[model samples]
Target: MALSDDTMRGVNLGGWLVLERYIKPSLFTVPECFDKGLHDPDVCTNDVDDAYPQDQWTLTGLFKNKDDARKYLKDHWANFVKEDDIIRIKNAGLGYVRIPVGHWIMGDISPDEPYVDGEWGDFVRVVKLCRKHGIQVWVDLHTAPGSQNGFDNSGRTLPTPTGVGWSGNPENVDRTIKAVRDIAEGIKQEGIEDVVTGFGVLNEPFKGQNEAQVKDFDDRAYRAVREVLGEGTTVYIADMFDAERFNGFWDDEEHGNTVLDSHYYHVFAQTPRGFSPRQHIAYVCEKNSRDVNACCWKGGGAGGGTSVGLKRMIGEWSVSFDTLVCTKLDDVMDSYREGGEVLEFTRKIGEKRKKFLRNFAEAQMVAWESQDTGVSVGWFYWNFKMEGGAFAEWDYLRGVEEGWMPTLKAEEKAEHVFGRCEEIIFRTDDEMDIVHEFPPSDSVAPDWQAVEADDDVVVSHGESLLTKGSRERGDGIVLGFLSLVVFLLLGLGIAKKCCVRYFGGAGGKGGYQRVGEVGGVGEVA
Candidate 1:
């Protein structure tokens, strides 16, 4: 079945099926591997150290054989996000869960590949458990055949921060598509297709460097999955950090039931790190709001001609303000100092960090759910929960426990949060100006009097018959009528001049007119 029209408030099941060292540090710590100094021949064949297995590929090397690797991974998968976690998710009022899976979950890993086996069964078990709890699933192929982004989360940690190889290698791209198809087929065979209503073809594929290849893979992978899952399923294509570039990618008729998945994180960039807590909330309420509205489908036209854009979802986002938390908080504090704030001022506000984080989270929720700004579908937090419950900002369960994330149950509660923020940041016109550096054109309130006047009947001669009877009107009706006539005459004159200039006139060649010319009727060509 297709995803419900209701906003998809969900959380990502990160570090479960696909391993990320940062998410679950304990899983990567293998004292035996460090002590024995043994590496997996397939992945750790390089000069790199095997002691620190940054990704799933290298982590498998720590085990003696496939059986050992399977046992270890199976244990982690079974316990990481068990039935209780699913129950907790449902109780938290979230309707969907995005489970990130490695490409090897399809059991197509070659002998040369260091990834373990039997994750497919564990993945199915998680989906079935979610089904029982009345929750939808977004199966995300987080890792591709050859690390799509060369990031550790892609299940392969490269020796260096090199560019992606998945798009460059045709076989890798094909394998990735096969993996997508396998996932769809598995869901079908397991009879969990109803709950597994969404499928993310790839997570965070670097589109900027491999636009053509990525587009081709998206088309092929989309078709491959659809061939098995049919049209009811929602196929997600990652925006790859460039949302504007792929704004209307899935709007066409051929791409029905497709969603552009975009991940939004403010902490990664320098500009956001410099923002004050209030500025961060304002940025979401204003700048991010405008961008979301621009990217989302406005619902008028058919196929690629849709009025605004494609169906979009904030596939991942979090309340985290800083990029990373090192052992010493002081090391990162200076880097994230607010713009123009002295060290003393930064430290003062640091005391009330929890309150600011709560406000920021609420602002995001309000903006993501706002019809005026949010994505057409909805949003999912970056993660359901991190390993140790240390990263509260990225962990939904921790955020709720700490009172930073709202225990959102209904739409009414969302509105209340919005109202509360409005009272603090967007309450007054001036306050609104503070939030929006460049206010949207539509932000200005319309002139009701002028709007009502527009409804008056106007003759071809530029005379208006006052619709509001003159008997009931004041003596100033003559002045109003005269003013309207004068305005119409000037407008007509300007239109005629614009026509003459464009179609050739005394001006010769009708080159162009500046804004200063013809009473500012035309722009410079």
Candidate 2:
């Protein structure tokens, strides 16, 4: 099926349905540990406790471990994100909401732990409210049974803060599939399937583990859900960390309705090339547009229908701007620590920086919408709200209110090039192989400069050449060929002229006479 105009404009209900340390740190509180010295030097490797100790910072950690405040935590689930949040999302002119949930929400994996079960009813309430407000939902299984991603957001992490949740154990994969089945089948049973646009089977499930097993497990989870949900359900799979590798996994018709989700973020951009934010923005837009489109459409060519059974979208994206060079902060959590510092730096530049950021955010939205890759069906901004206030690019509601992101729902026509087809026309059964790419962006190209090189050959643009010798050889071949051609033509013309003048004359013999025969006649004269 083709994408609708409104389908693409959505916001993630982050930190509300799911607990992320950076988005809602207070929810991960460990009040009992307050008496203990800040960070308890022994428990946390980084002894700085401007936030909760890393060990007690995740949703699963807050319940499974002793320091986690369980009593207060249960109450947080009800109060953190309310019905009003859903109303606000609708009012923001967004038509979609990506609700992230952990597998534990289905059942307590560790029942012996002191943690009481959370109200799964809260999730049902959120999904219902979103449906009531006409907002399509993508129920994303953000945290799998094993920490899919070895991060606090994964619901649990290793004591050393590594994520080893999916240890290739058969049980981990089984539990995860069961949880996904519950969520997908539950949505179907509720009779609200129309409002539920898709079910994301996994979110960022990557660890330094067996790559092959992980892929098999991903495919198995999707197949299990498809088996339950049937051929009509839209199941989305997070490209298992490497989007390119997992691009065509769901190309088969048996996969049913599916889309590949990959996140696009620039906080991790490294700048040895000295790219300014503007240049970096251009580079990402161009590069991802190509890569994502390449991933989406696979068959005869781009927009090719060999893979119409599969589709793609950016399940998570953000306008939060920071390079490794600017703040040395790599992840959102690290950036959260120094948000105020970055804001202060922005304030020093007055509105100049803010203006640049607003443009940057719009540029990103435009880029994703106009992707050359088989079209990014739609994208969900990383978050709708966060604790970081105006500086938070993850917060889509704030970005729109603050003038960074464009409002696509209420507009007369889609503004982005890729979004020009607000009313999508699906291909006929036979012509399904045809697909389209987003229009190219009208922006300044990246500024490139040659750097001092150590190697004899330098890579420029995308080619390698022995410049001096190559140029000389090319010129020599052309000049030499021209000279030979000219000599041949001149010699042929002279021979023709001699034949015409001597042989064609009145007394000319049919056969030619040599100069030596004429010399012998001169002796008689």
Specify the highest-lDDT model's number: 1
Looking at model 1, the pairs that clash are: none
> Against the hidden reference, what TM-scores do the models get?
0.71, 0.67
Question: Tens digit of lDDT per residue, candidate 1, span 116-212?
Answer: 7687777888888998998999999998877887778888866543335788888888889889998889899999988899999999886535687
Say which candidate scores most in TM-score: 1
lDDT at position 26, candidate 2: 39
In model 2, the Cα lDDT at residue 195 comes to 76
- lDDT for 409 in candidate 1 is 67
What value of lDDT does candidate 1 attain over all alpha carbons?
A: 0.63
For candidate 1, what's the RMSD? 14.2
